[model samples]
Target: MNDRLGRLRDTTINLAHGSGGRAMRELIEDVFVMAFDNPALAALEDQAVFPLADLVRHGDRLAFTTDSYVVDPLFFPGGDIGTLAVSGTVNDLAMSGAKPLFLSCGMVIEEGLAVDILRRVAASMQRVAIEAGVSIVTGDTKVVERGCADKLFVNTAGVGVVPAGVSISARRAQAGDVVIVNGFLGDHGTAILVARQQLALQSDIESDCAPLASLVAAMLDTREDIHCMRDATRGGVATVLNEFALSSGVAIRIHEAALPIREEVKGACEILGLDPLYLANEGKLVAVVPAHAAERVLAAMHAHPAGRHAGVIGEVVAQPAGIVVLHTGFGGQRIVDMLVGEQLPRIC
Candidate 1:
């Protein structure tokens, strides 16, 4: 039985591991199954089945989201592609005020990749899943020819339950609503740039990749009137604000002084000729809420470890609809336009 089951040794990945034969099964069992162990996945079936009653008890609607991670450096200062994949998906579901439940992972590995590296990535996914109170119930794996793909890529799809009577959307923002950001911006992008070591610069910046489910839940618990919540991702906080303005037909006005940025990240962006506002961040989120509830929600966010740096940076307005403007610290106001082109690609 042991011989028939095959084994995944501390060696490099080959094409046969994805062949759907005994090797493939062994790879799944040894790496993925061992790390993401749960009753649903332990079954080793093609699909995962859930109890309908349990799902219904959480909410009436289901929030489904999918994201693909192709970060250039597989590993960076604070996280890897595996950690980003899980956090990204969980944050997506949390954006809708949903309680994230299950996830599906898909891995595309290049031939000759180290088996130990795959193990490390799988372990990362498992750790993040356990921290977020979610499960990896189903998944698929594939291997590509050498040079056809990067060292590793991960794709995650997640589903969550949106509690009854909780409605959060970009279009829900209205005039007088306050804008709040959870923490520092541009950390992830700057960290990746520094990790590349292409520029001879030194700074202590780390990717802010983290699951935001708990933070979101805390905000919801304080009040269900959250107008909108979105993780500042690929295009950073600037892109998210523009999305909200366009979606709600409202203008957003932000104060430059209120924007939160790490000193290291700020210096790096200055040297790189980039704007921290346009840089990507993994763990931060932007939320819009009624002025009356802003203080309470901000207090709630401050209590959460992920949002200890929460700050109110902007407000929604009625004039100049579909636009975002930044009130400069220099007593000037300028349009915060949507990113014209990719500032930095593959940072995510």
Candidate 2:
């Protein structure tokens, strides 16, 4: 049996691997279980069991979020589906000022996928989960026939505990709030596009796919009065700002010069006639904080690696509620509204 399972490691996935038979058990035990080794996961139970007392020590509220990753090619410059699965959900929890505790991974893998590929992805997930100080406590795997699914797709659901007295919501933005972003924007979307090789473009840009829990923790430590926070994922900063504006019934105005966009990303956007504001970001976040805490938060963010490029980009206003405005570098002001349609598909 050991020899058979060892041989399976060098081979490819087949329908039997998902049949809930010996093959399925071997795959799970050899690949996922070994990679994500932890007491909660080692029990091999249907659900991860945690003591209620262990959870309540962190906070009074619970933060739960889930996200799916189907980025074409599976592997990109900076990360893969596994990395995305962990970071995406972890970021979601952190956006609520929660301390991410555990994650559940769900994978839909196509038949004939190289076992080595699966191992690599599982390893990536473990590594990122460790970096984010979280555990992969439970998961499920399914192998579909070739062409029935993409090469690989990952879904992750995360659970965290929100600290007491920390209240973050989209509707918390106020007129005197200041907007800030962590690091560069649009690298993830642009990197995926370039990786497709359809545009025949060349650049050294890499996706900013990283877990933001620590960065958020540092910001929260600086001050817990952060009004609103959201990872600029699918619709980028523009979408998040729009959501905040509409939810809080306030207008947001951002400065173009202050926007932290890479030159390579800007060049790609100009050629494709795309707006960097709408491009997706994996590691970036939009934070609406009180004006007084802006500098302090920015300083704290700069002290961390993930937020080294943090900057104050915009501020909330009273008039024109539910609108986002941009101060163009050309000395013109324009309304930056929600993205009309998909700018880049299969990104993040």
By TM-score, the best candidate is: 1
Model 2: per-residue Cα lDDT over 1-348, one tens digit each:
233344244379998888887888788888898899897776667799889899999999989999988889789999988998899999999999999999999889899999988899999999999999999999888999999998888999999999999999999999999999998999998999889985568899999999999999999998649999999999999999999999999999999999999999999999899899999999999999999999899999999999999999999999799999999899999999899978888986
- How far in Å is the alpha carbon of 129 misplaced in model 2? 0.3
TM-score of 1: 0.98
**Candidate 2 positional error at 171, Å:** 0.5
Candidate 1 lDDT by residue in tens digits, 1-348: 243355676488889988888778888888998899997886778899998788899899999999999997989999998899999999999999999999999999999999899999999999999889899999988999999999888999999999998999999989999999999999999989988985468877889999999999999998649998999999999999999999999999999999999888888887889999999999999999999998999899999999999999999999899999999999999999988899887987
The segments of candidate 2 whose C-alpha lies over 4 angstroms from its true place after superposition are 1-10
- Record all residue pairs in model 1 with backbone atoms less than 3 Å apart, i.e. clashing: none
Pairs clashing within candidate 2? none
Query: Residue 211, candidate 1: how far off, in angstroms?
Result: 0.3
Model 2 root mean square deviation, Cα atoms = 1.9
